[model samples]
Target: MALFTNIARIQDGLLLCSDSDEEADYTKYQNYAKQLFQKLEAMEQKIDKFSIEESEFTYHYYIANGVCYLGFFKKNYPYRAVFAYLKELEEEFRRIYNQQEIEEANRSFTFIKFESVIRNLRQKYTDDSSLADKNIQQLSENLTDVQRIITKNIKEVLERGEKLETLNLASSKLSNESKVYAIKARNFKWRMWWKTYSPLIIIAAIVFLVLFIKFFIW
Candidate 1:
């Protein structure tokens, strides 16, 4: 039989169990119980969605390029998986945002991803009615808005770039045409000048020839 088999009593909210032996083995059992409790708490947290009041959300912005847009982040948010996804987007569009011009865009994408994942997780938690599910509904909605804005802006920028290219090509063609027309006009002027001088020289030569012939006959 254990040395302290029945001596252990309930202290606070923990089971104070002791071993019925010369050296008590409470340490082992206590450690095991603590581990189990931790696991249970973690499980519970997963099932319940944490509420985030809208009033706490002061960082939300809409971004658009032309056709569609996405959200931007203001502060770093906790959520590893979601933040990783957002980091990818930021890296992809870093050049478009003029990295140095607005540091906010980078931050915004991160927050949006974090919020989106949390919202999905919350929905899942709600379905099961778990206390661990921390549903960030407000953040999720904001992320959606940001995505819309970013998509629109990106599309617009692409369209605008295409248009600029088209206009550049057309202008180049016009410039070439003008040069060709100028060359043709110069050639026509040269021909007209030669024609105008040749007649006068011919008339002078004819008059000189008649005078020379009359002088010889006399």
Candidate 2:
């Protein structure tokens, strides 16, 4: 059975930190949500909806009115229900709070009151009987396959960090190798110059010594 783990509201990439009783780690989920928000921001065109899949949970996010509503659900959770929940949350949030208040709030979980709202919604959506509910059934019917849309595996996400670390290490090693090669080439050039010119230098010294002795003796 898929569970509703968490919900959040983000604006302009900043999470409106709110107090929550949900079992999922808020800090970790917040970081994941921020990464998703950044990906959306990077796109030239705005995307109103997207999903990211992690090992334990899949995230469904909705963007509206400059605020992002993010939800964490079990992998098999119905995405349509998840989205409908987000939409309801978004609408309710907008109804209760103005844009200026949402934007100006700097404290974490500033909207702690919403936690109860989420709990209530989660119960309604997660219940088996809710599947037969007209609203949920309609939502499920209207939506496309959640698995097919913009899904990212948790392993791939972790591997990306590992790959970046590997690239940095490789780059540092290559830079050090180049520096060592340059120093060796300079030393080799000096040694070759010494070998090529030593005899000529010795001959010149001998010739000068002979010229001095002859001038003095004569």
Candidate 3:
């Protein structure tokens, strides 16, 4: 069963719109969603789509055109189905909200009108009808091996948010070290070549000098 769906701008981690399910108390999950958005923001667009498992719920998300479409579902729900749901939402969102509107928005829920579209699509996939199930199976197969998608526990994700800056600094240090190693390797190669060929080069020069004296000076 679908629990909730939220769409946000990936660049600034600002909510754009979502399904307004009034019956469920999703406050806890909403907090986690906020932290997850921060994690995504720090990731610098490394991963666009993924899932996180916490308690008995799983969040499946997809990022396209700088917007992230994410949803929540029961742990037993076919994660593939959630991904299919996100894909449909992405298309509907792009059709309704142009690039300029998506980029220019300065506040959350700028296009709250998309909530109705989200509610309808969520129902379409989560329904128990045979056709809906079959459609989920077929459409989601294209997103093959979603089970292999990066799934992390809530603790790891939240804690890693603090460590992302350190990781980035370490990455920059490693890159600089790599460049130094490359320069050293090139110098070592040139030195070995000089050591191997210097004797032959010196002999060639001596022979040319001797020939000049024998033919011309003598």
* Candidate 2 lDDT score relative to the true structure: 0.55
Candidate 2, pairs of clashing residues: 17-108, 17-109, 18-109, 19-109
Segments in model 3 whose C-alpha atoms lie over 4 Å from true places:
128-152, 162-218
What TM-score goes with each of the models? 0.19, 0.55, 0.65
How would you encode candidate 1's per-residue C-alpha lDDT over 172-215 as one tens digit per residue?
A: 23223324333433454566667889899899999989998989
Candidate 2 RMSD to the real structure: 26.8
The C-alpha lDDT values of all candidates are 0.28, 0.55, 0.67
Model 3: per-residue Cα lDDT over 1-218, one tens digit each: 46888898887889988774689899889878876776666554655556677888887667777888878887766544555466668888999889999999999889988888888886665443233455445433443422243344776768755433322122223223324433433455566679889999999999999999999999
Predicted structure 1: lDDT: 0.28
Better of 2 and 3 by TM-score: 3
Q: If the candidates were sorted by their TM-score against the true structure, best first, what order would they fall in? A: 3, 2, 1
